[model samples]
Target chain A: MDAMVEQGPEGSFVLGKVDDLLNLARKNSLWYMLFGTACCAIELMQTGGPRSDADRFGMVFRATPRQSDTLILAGTITYKMASRIRLLYEQMAEPKYVIAMGSCANTGGLFQESYAVVNGGDLFLPVDVYIPGCPPRSESLIEGLMLIQQKIEKEPWLKKAWTNTKNPKDPQIEGLL
Target chain B: MTSEALIDYVKGLLGDKTKWADPEAGDNFLTVASEDWKNICQTLATDKKCSLTYLRNFTGTDYPEDDEIELTAHTFSYSEKHGLIIKTRISREAAVCDTLSKIWPAAIWYEREIFDLLGVSFNNHPDLRRILMPEDWVGHPLRKDYKQQETYRGIPTTRPA
Candidate 1:
């Protein structure tokens, strides 16, 4: 349904309605899981700290995956930790989002050649937004959160994300363990 | 005590069992055969003249050209305030050496680390398992000829070629 609007003498302005209201609510209250794997974790903590204050955007961290709507992967993902990441992603509610918060989580960064590191978070769980930098600054993470909010505002509650949210070729990266 | 004096003291106890390492080098480091490792370590730790009571560092290095892995142990005596560098070489085909864990106590974990990285086995080691790598890891990464597996679980161990 089209958003309601009332005609003013000078111009027209849309009225707050059911769909717009849902979008507003969804965009504001994004509870992300409290998770970090490496150096990027320090930046993640700074994002939640007073100066950067992610809480101003209505973003707070949940202790468990089940209660959170977002996952901010804040470091390197080794083959050993990939399965646990998958399990955490699966535990989140259906309308979940993932933020790959640093170069390591995005493309394995310095550890790319390492025999143990996973190339990217998307290899195991679908990543919605990727924040670059070996370890992205706290402000960058806040910007990433804002982008997730923008995405939530445009997306419908029942509709799946437009981007393909599929686990890569293999569910688990096979190794000794 | 100086390194030279320390070398002489060890020689007095073990006689021909120990020898000055690297004849060309002036350092007092001593090298013992793999078969004499356990006995030399015990005598050095217990005997009053040379009590190497503390195990400062115990590690292994791979020598691919020589086809042997060298195990080095650095021990110190709190009473004497002197240290000794003991080394033993084991064949790469069967990189096994006696465990000094019983004498040094602190050597148990170091022995496990050597076993983990360089694939050097310690005879009679209480728990010889991978200490740095995952327990299920295929091969010792520190070995000179180690070949990383193509995939661990289902994830490619390397970046796209």
Candidate 2:
């Protein structure tokens, strides 16, 4: 199958492993949910804007969680918002990813000692990539999206579906209703 | 108008109900008894001479050393362009104060926020509930001695050191 691309008539046909083809399609069009709870959300918007041009990497913002492939938690997660965040995560389709896109979302940032703020988004959601900044610059958020793209490229989607497997060390996030 | 004139105007209206007026400090607020708070606020808002019709800011502060919680209301008049600060102290154990929503409708949400953070209970705030914290939150977070609970609905509140 490796020689199929070279042997085929010019621009007529090509062949690749099913996993690679699927991953290729998945990595390019990562639809992130439009959710921002704090200051870092500004950077998230800037990343998607003209200068950072997140759309260039095939990343776009989805308004609802049901259609999103990525959840960028772009600010502080107070205890009150934690359950709502979990609900949003649960609503996202399977094979979804999370990018904790600021110091607050990463480790409660400045509000770490506050009575209301959750320590980090990882406490309630499985975070895929963490972008570190009080409010990370637009460039940093784009970098995080690129990291997610890289991560999607390596996932064996078909194999995992066939085995009915799950990610190892998935935290038990029960009773958050 | 100057703070002294404002204090004198309010004093002339409420008489002994105005417990003490401090015009020389940071806020220039008049401390009124909690029992007379509602009446005094009504007078301030309704009286043409001291028409403090707008509720500028309403907040509560917990003083652990004094064993009291002070509720302050900064009132302003759009037509007059003058403001007055009114304060009332409640025992921390009770933390109950009369609702000013009747005098100025804006006090409703402000009172709810104060209740949410400082544990102050407004006697007749129509819709009294938590405005900032979760409905099931354990304690008022703004209290000086507040201790955050370990977890909220199975989500840990603190990061591992």
Q: Over 4 Å off in model 2, which ranges? A: A1-4, A8-15, A162-168, A172-174, B21-25
Candidate 1, residue B102: how far the Cα is off, in Å: 1.8
Candidate 2 - chain A - TM: 0.89
In order, the Cα lDDT scores of the candidates are: 0.83, 0.85
Candidate 2, TM-score vs. the true structure?
A: 0.93
Clash count, candidate 2: 0
Clashing pairs in 2: none
State which candidate has the highest lDDT: 2
Q: TM-scores of the models, in the given order?
A: 0.84, 0.93
The digit string of per-residue lDDT tens for model 2 on B62-125 reads 8999999998888998888889888899999988888988889999999999999999988878
**Clashing pairs for predicted structure model 1, backbone only:** A173-B152, A173-B153, A173-B154, A173-B155, A174-B152, A174-B153, A174-B154, A174-B155, A175-B152, A175-B153
A1-177: candidate 2 lDDT, tens digit per residue = 132554545555666778788888899999999999999988888888889988988999999999999999999988778878888887787888899988899999898888888888888778999999989999898899899988888887887763214445654355666
